[model samples]
Target: MDVDGRNSTIGYGASASGMTDFSRTDAERANPGHDTRQSFQGDGMRGRVLAIALTLATLIGALPVAGSLWVAWGSANRARTDMLDGAVHEMLARYNRMSTEIDQVFDDLSSLPLAEACEPVGLMRLRTAAYFSRGVREVAVIENGRILCTGAGKSDMPASLPLPDMSEGDVRIWYDRVPPDVRAPASDVARSTVIARNGFALFLDTEQIYDLVLTDPRTVLSMVSLTSRQVMGVRSRPERAMLSDMVDRFRTDPPPRSLRVGNRLIVAAPTADGAAMALAAQPIDVVLEAWRQQAVPLGLLGLTSGAIIFWLILTLARRGDTMGARIRRGLARGEFRVVYQPIVRLSDGACLGGEALVRWQQRDGTMISPDRFIPVAEAEGLIERLTDQIIEHVFADIGKFLAERPTVWIAINLSAPDVESDRVRGRLDRLRKTHGVAADQIVLEATERTLIDARRAQSSMRSFRDAGYRLTIDDFGTGYSSLAYLATLPVDGLKLDKTFVDSIGSGTPADDVMGHILSLAATLGLDVAAEGIEHGAQADYLIARGVTYGQGWLFARAMEAETFGAYVDGRMAVAGPPSRRRRA
Candidate 1:
């Protein structure tokens, strides 16, 4: 031992100076030009050997990776083009089918006698015809831009029709504004066209084609006039201007081979009716997703490509460190506060306990959950200090209120170290005595991870019970909880994990697991309290199955101690008591 009472390893001082031998040797070699022909020749051979090895490696490794990437790059483009082409074709095909169906309906309607279309009985026939036709909202008869009559429950047709100047026997599509006098029909489908017969024209519904054809919100299908180049119908609201731009630009100059804007691309194909080009603007993200599956093979090109996993680990470490810093700062600044989530008897909603949940409330009125920061605290060795901070505030804030409601338990969670630590019993005992509250009113929630040393855990839990504090195995069934642990641990109740509770009655395998857990708890004669009972059905399911207590948003969220008092008051006013249901 040194004079300062520090122990020193043998030869520790020698290592500090002896590490400089190579520097002194190099200094000696450089002095006065000491000849080094043999050394130089050896180094030259080594340099050549290293260079040759690196060159061969570069040739072998770079070629395959580069070639693979190049192939993937081309495949990605081809796949992207194919994906967009498929979307465009799908749009065109849908509109074409709608047109074909409408044209068939038009063929049937045009052959009707013009006199019959203008009669009241003929109007009933017209209304019935409009009902049978697909995508037809209302039918009207027109004679040389003059409104004649419509189907039943007549909507005023436009006095002057703006028909696209189509040559005789030629059909065209164009946009026409709906008149304000039109009334909405029962059926939602719409198709409008002026079919000339003799001197009169038949007007059919038009606007509902966008719904019949387009399901995608991003892609737009526009019907453009062949000669006048007017926009007839647009499927999507956002892509309406893009379609107009394409039409205006395509008319002024030769059409651009590719029409793309930022991450959105425009794909156009000739419509089935040959009257318009079906142009659609789709996000490039769709193309990227289609091609992502093909580039996965490039991962096999590098034998040591496992570094991404290491990089991920490092990234997570950095994030943990950032979160750790925030927790440490929070401890200093007192940014965390304890909120109480109500635990109630399942049969009726009565406040039996309040679970202490820590929340980080920033000054800007945003809350960060304990789940995000608790694991970070545990990993960073700051859990004990964090818990201490919360408990101290709780005692200062609500020790008197808890003493008044002696039957209502205030549950606080503990870490693995807390269960085995020497100071826990002393601190808890002191707190209980100081608050003048019985230990039964203090429920310590713990998870299976706290049973690091089973014997020590059992001892600590027994000590807690002897002091009159209730014990709960929190987040039960999530970790190392098993029959052995349950049989051995000295806990009063099992708090069902939220994951299982969320899945209750969902018909998942979790429902079966819940039954198993309940059955096991019953056999062991343990009280069962289920957390995260968000739905009424979940609470009813547990209550019918004899769960002792329930805690979740279905009843109330965690609140301040004063708020909890108000909540309890409200509950007592409605429900009878925490022990049992009141017979009405």
Candidate 2:
């Protein structure tokens, strides 16, 4: 019975142990279906949280980024559009100004009686007008294919005037007179249309209108143009584009409440009944360029901030400092000096005077030429002070020289601004009194370029001369020396420009031209002084041909006060061959 029971127990135990399967039960408990579903749900929740965080970040960053970009792009585009539009508008404004000026000129011309137009008084008036209107290359009154009158350079055009074809419309709107080449057919001869009273026209060259309009920077300004759509007479590529775009966009439809081209914004108006359009372009590019340049500073500030931030974060930034302050401080120390160059008489080799030339000495003792700093000084308004200092020094030197030699003359080349200022005259008067120097002992050499206002110059010079001061016209032949003005002006002498003197006997036509000028000056009783006579031959030639005086290297280069004094004292000798001298 015990054996049977033991065997049954063993069998039961074995079966129970085998059926239990502890590892399989543990696996089933750990991975129950409900638990698996809950695990998958947890993982999905985490993934959704990550995606939400990423999407939130993108939204946070991209909104302002896109908005700012849109605002910037829109502003830039508007500014660009405004600039282009403004360019056209400004061009039109310039055209209007030019047109007004032209009308005024015509009015002035017409106001003159027909009889006076050809007289000397008329010529004087015309020449005065021409001088004031220097931009006008030429002026002519053409009547029936013949030039009725001209101020200057009239022979360059055809002797016989040519009339233009005017089938399209009245050509008088564009031209004052017609050339003979474009004269209308005898059968098509219409009665001359009076454009501006005395300003009448028989025909107009459409080509000349285009040429005139295109020459001005304000008209067909520097711009890109589309060749295909260009008007018949419009030569400017940019103008063509502007005109085409304007016509295409604004011709049919009224202008928008506001329009922009480039950076300029402007108002538009229709022109010429139904055929033409006009727009005014204001200078928006300047403003835009300024704004754009400002961004550089802002960007630099941003970079500096970023660098500071980076330094704060990484602890690896350098100190922010520069040498500009030190350099400025050095400049404030006043380390500038002046040198003098003597001007002398050519005939007697007499030291007449000197021009004070300034120099800048750096802290390191390196001297900088006046040409570099003089412009800077002028722009900064420091030139007046500089000039005063130079004048004081010069007057002191002159006083010292005159203490021994009273007959010597000193010429000072004054800047245009100085010459224009009343203070300069006052200073000269004070200097004359202080130095006991007669006004004739000091010569003021002024250039024609500096004489911008003839009336003012005439008045100023007359006053100076009346005060016993001598005035010399310097660089005489270089500019538009009008014969009419030269004949009328009370200038004591003319300084023939170095360019003309240099060109003399160079086998160029200019030599004969200069000879004619010399003759003209002699006839007018004006003293002629030849300038830049570097060669003895040139000086001899000038003196032989009645050139009264000369200044050049042939006699001497500009020298120091001591050397010049020695030359005046007959100690330093000039090594040139004797020149044929003439009296002034």
lDDT of 2: 0.48
lDDT for residue 387 in candidate 1, whole number 0-100:
73
- What are the lDDT figures for the candidates, one per model? 0.59, 0.48
Q: Which candidate's lDDT is highest?
A: 1
Counting only residues 3 or more apart in sequence or on different chains, how many pairs clash (N, Cα, C under 3 Å) in candidate 2? Answer: 34
Model 1 TM-score on a 0 to 1 scale: 0.44
lDDT by residue (tens digit), candidate 1, 1-584: 01001111122212211110000112222342331111112234345644554554444444455565666666766655555466556556555544544554556666778777767776776675555454455566666656577675334554666665554464433345453235686243343545544433445454444443333456554556655555656665435466556665544334553466667666666665566665565676665654566556653553333454345443443332356766786788798777676778877677776777666654444344443456667767788787787677777767888777666667777777677675666777787789887777787877654652455577877887777677777766654223334656777778776777778768898787788778878777778988777788888888888898887767876677799878776665343223312110
Q: Name every residue pair that clashes in candidate 1.
A: 175-232, 191-205, 191-206, 192-205, 192-206
Candidate 2 residue lDDT tens string, 377-485: 5444555565566567667655667545556666665555666576667888898788787767676767655553444567677777677766666666554334334
What's the residue-level lDDT of 50 in candidate 1? 48
Model 1 root mean square deviation, Cα atoms: 26.5
- In model 2, the worst 10-residue window by lDDT is 1-10
Structural similarity to truth (TM-score) of each candidate = 0.44, 0.55
